[model samples]
Target: MALGLFWATVCLCVFVAVLSLDIMGFFSRGNKFQVEGRTVILTGGSYGMGKEVAKLLSQRGANLIIVARNVDKLKAAIEYAKSHAKNPSTQRFHYISADVCSEAENERLLKEATEWNNGKIPEIVWANAGSSTPMMWLESSIETQKQQMDMNYWATAYLAHKTLKAWLYPQTPYSPREKSAKAEAPRHFIMTSSAICFYSFTGYNPYGPAKWAMRGLCDGLRQEVLLYNGARRSTKKTGQEPAPFDINIQMVFPGNMKTPGHELENLTKPPITFILEKDDPEQTELAAATAAIKGLEAGNYYTSTNWLCDVMRISALGGNPRDNIIKDTVGQWLTSIVWLFVGPDLDGKVWNWGKKEGMPELKPEKRIAR
Candidate 1:
């Protein structure tokens, strides 16, 4: 038993040392990518996190193509972008007002953006529009659920579909010369999936599942974006250079923020949710945007602010991951079991909430308190 314990200790130490090195990037991918002078199409850019992201990128000399359903707000966003840009003389800003949930609208936005930018595909395409209607799953209508899917999932998917054609797909004989001309210029596709993507609370309901679906899609898309090994070998065998596969996929899972929508969500949020969120009321939009930019520049495959989000993210990595490995599959299972046990109790509390004196309906008839 003494010898077995000794070996176990040694193995654990070795594992920690390796993981630590990987986390420190001693054995990680190069993070030399730059956002400077890049053209970007940012959805939901009128206000909140989207507006903040635009400001940060503009300050770094990136051109902005801001989109949202609010023309007045989008125009203001463009003015902000222009004034703050590192090189205002060289910077360009455009605004479009369209509902991002419409695939046709998104397609038109993409077309107009590319055309306005002198036929240059944006270096970064950011899907930042998202919404949540707070209610229990049973209380939320199917329309409410579908609205979440449209904004959080389909919008991102449509953007990725259009952008990746220019960013990822390798050139063929039939490929357009203009597309093949520039070896993919390290394009970035950024999507905003909430920290709730990792786990859902009682009041979050459909919104949580919608975000989870978005995260799952991002994971699968990350894998699918890989340039085929066969293509790489074939190029080398034929003494031809392989096309550059510089498309970077980044998904940010931000914690609660002091956005307008957040205020709207709070009216119906569960008492238990506040207990779980126990952190300071709101992480400023600026702070969240800063963390996101830093993470993207550092090549983090998964970027987040809250401790809970990080814990859940690190715990979800598989046999192969680009970074973050605090524990293995077995440890993750154990951790999940703990949450699983806690989950039912949370539900029970919620169930009892309904039975309490003057309890508000999960879908309160009047959302905001007068």
Candidate 2:
């Protein structure tokens, strides 16, 4: 009877151990970053994908500071975002009319975010402002190209720089309670790049290179964050306290969306460009915003509304995060091969129809009735 009791006790201990591990696994699966109550400073937040993101974050109870160049548009966007807020009485919606591309403006934006709400700094920063003019590299001016780069690449870099500096520069030793609080609140930076950063079509000269630079910037930022993680782990392994750094990075490569920027870009696009998007299902600004939010909730490093677009990024896989390791490796090579064939066909379209029609700078072309 004593022997029987000993065996039963062993079985009970095993069962308890298994149950504990399962519970730990559930919480450690992945970081689910929710936007609720987090201060989110979104650039280009007045229109297009930015506007939609504001609405979604507002509904989720995020305190917002929308940055844009236009005051009138900012006011309208503020009203729109507030109306969608889960609790308008409590949610803070403020607008900063500043050109985020400028260095001074970017710095000021960060200062405001830190000082807002009685010294509560922003936990989430969304670099979602960019515009591209549809012109071949040879046809585009150097100044216009530089301006585009300022908006697309420089703005993203500025925001990342500010947030990373803010985190790393203020590394402080915390008490047990402070350490627990730090572990609970992680910082997130999401930058909006373009799928063209991976694969470019014809007439995407200046824009393609500018967006490609954004991807490069994101890669560098994420790698630096990983380095911080490595140092923290190394310190902890040495039985010393790790430096306080808990940050996550996400790069968004969005496809076409129905926004003012999209419409304006389409006005100057080649006929082949129109042909390419004709078959794809309609995607709106809200849809793109929804995908971004969902990606954040899922803790994905790369996010996009279109599956093909996401696959294209992984397929390129230069410095991008792998999808699922083995699955992503296979998918990358397979998709790369398929694109090898599709790419040349697209090149043919460029060679065949390379006319620049419907440019607003030039007079409208007269169309004859059939």
Candidate 3:
């Protein structure tokens, strides 16, 4: 009867609606971020926000393996991680000395870490290894631009690929425990890209290009992973799921940050070595240096106590970008449009961890002792 057909249709629609909601919720639930009990390998962990992240992770009972070129600082950071860790007995902290810019070093670091952990491969690898060039026009020598590209973009891309291919891939040497874990669950890949990957700045010079490449790297990698995941899901294959390898990439646009000098001795060297002159003595050199040191102590980009935390919070809460005509044109016409559109969203998405609000006044304990 017509009445009976209508009732059946209504029930079918309700069931479909409920199923849709459940499906949407399933994807949404997967996207949430959580960090605990994972083994994390962080480059540039000897200094700056990288060190702090490692410390925080250690507190959360995550094992840490830190890498940087400086052996002494790496050891110090490992000690710091151990000291700050909440459950030292369960946490594992190791330091590998390597220049992240070097492909060989990156490979060695990944292989050794995997081997050293008794095949307990790191679940998360943080490619936070970076060095900034002096802000200048792109007119600087080719060498300067090359260094920026190598240190920032190429180093980041190389390390990221190595981590994904070397450690995350199944065919490569895998620990027995890791293989068993993979049989149970997949892994995640995280990258610390910049918000600058979105917009252009007046002073970026060669640095902007380097960051843009990183943005591209993340986008391409994300798309590739999505495709792989989709293909795996679509396949009629039913048995055990393939290792769930997901790429979680975030381009963090931290405003200006007060980062400590990695190589103090190198900075102290003559300006001639860097192909640039030092700021005039009467200029605001001392004030600039002091402010940078203080900013790091306060952990503020602007005035916020934790710049990164604020960025992450803002990213969570949707925000809009200032529609600058010139910047928008540059973004749309010159570079990758995807990042240009997503850059603003990504700016505060992960965590600023830079100087956004004015930095806080430093107390004695916060001050770097001479």
Candidate 4:
């Protein structure tokens, strides 16, 4: 009878948890990311997931300005996005060719985008240009490490700094009463990070740290934006002209994607790296972008593109905002318990690989193709 009662209690607890999650989902059903009739600037939109995101945003009625280094690819991407526009005649689309890794180029791109939008800054800016070169730490050169950081972290940081300054500290400040309804809506700054940001593996030494830095930047800015958003609500008491609108900082953690960049990354990936991540599922550019857009619309601060990415994200959530506090807490607890065993298992695999293969050569005979 005691055993029977224990089982019944466990079942009741599970039922209650399921019911609570259902209720939470019901309450959060409405779309929080409203992009209709808004201007959106998307970086690295010439190909892959960025291009897919641009197409999705066009379907949702956003005016698009896609930025990339290749003018021909950027032109193609713009045409593709325009073809999918919800209101083809009303929705406008343009492409800009510039290397975003340069700080001056970022400033110039934003200025041109603002001018194109008729003196209004874009309502949404997504820093989606990033690359990876996977190799052992010792095998990778200092130049490769610095290039990784510049491409993945510094590029996004530069664009984000310029965009936020324009949004939060405009030269021509206007009172709350002077802004229109469209201008009063929240602005979004989305950063594209990788699943490696949450966990590091052997072959990612050159690339993982850069993504981790991007995650750190996102976390810090997420908290700092709260101060400005609060000031917007208390403008009367502070007697200062409020910033135009609330700024929402979000980040996307995408796992293995089937893109040209991913293909290039695989050319340099160590055999051990492949073995470690073989079980991780891969998503197409469209699928990954679709999942990211869904997460944004659901108002998630840190969006994960796949189940494995979600697991990694929750395991290292730190101070990031939770999508659902109860759900995230439960997930964190479960992930911690699983990691207790999984962590050692991974380490054992790496140890066994070294024992079986011995030390690999410092450099392979063939250099990675650019």
The candidate that wins on TM-score is 4
Residue 62 lDDT (model 2) = 89
Which model is ahead, 1 or 2, in terms of lDDT? 2
lDDT tens digits, residue span 267-314, model 1? 766566676566534678998888888778777788876656666665
Clashes (backbone N, CA, C under 3 Å), per candidate, total 0, 0, 12, 0
Clash pairs, model 4 backbone: none
Give lDDT tens digits, candidate 4, residues 82-146: 99999998998988888998998998898888878877788899999988899888888888899
Candidate 4 lDDT score at position 29: 73
* TM-score-best of 2 and 3: 2
Candidate 3 local lDDT, 1-370, one digit each (tens): 9999999999989766766674454323231334456677888778766777677667768788998988889998899879988887777788999887888888788888887677766777767766655443423567767876887788888877877665435566543334342422335454554444544443455566887787667657755666556644566665544455554443333333445542432333222323221221221222332332232223222211233322322332222221222323333344444445555643443234224434434322111111
Q: Which prediction has the highest lDDT against the true structure? A: 4
- Candidate 4 has an lDDT of 0.89
Structural similarity to truth (TM-score) of each candidate: 0.82, 0.81, 0.61, 0.92
* Candidate 1's TM-score: 0.82
Worst 10 residues of 1 by lDDT: 170-179
Ranking by lDDT: 4, 2, 1, 3
Error of 3 at 80 (Å): 1.3
Candidate 2 Cα lDDT to native? 0.76
Stretches of candidate 2 exceeding 4 Å from the true structure = 1-31, 171-182, 234-243, 276-281, 354-370
User: Alpha-carbon error at 256 in model 1, in Å?
Assistant: 0.7
Q: Cα RMSD for candidate 3?
A: 13.7
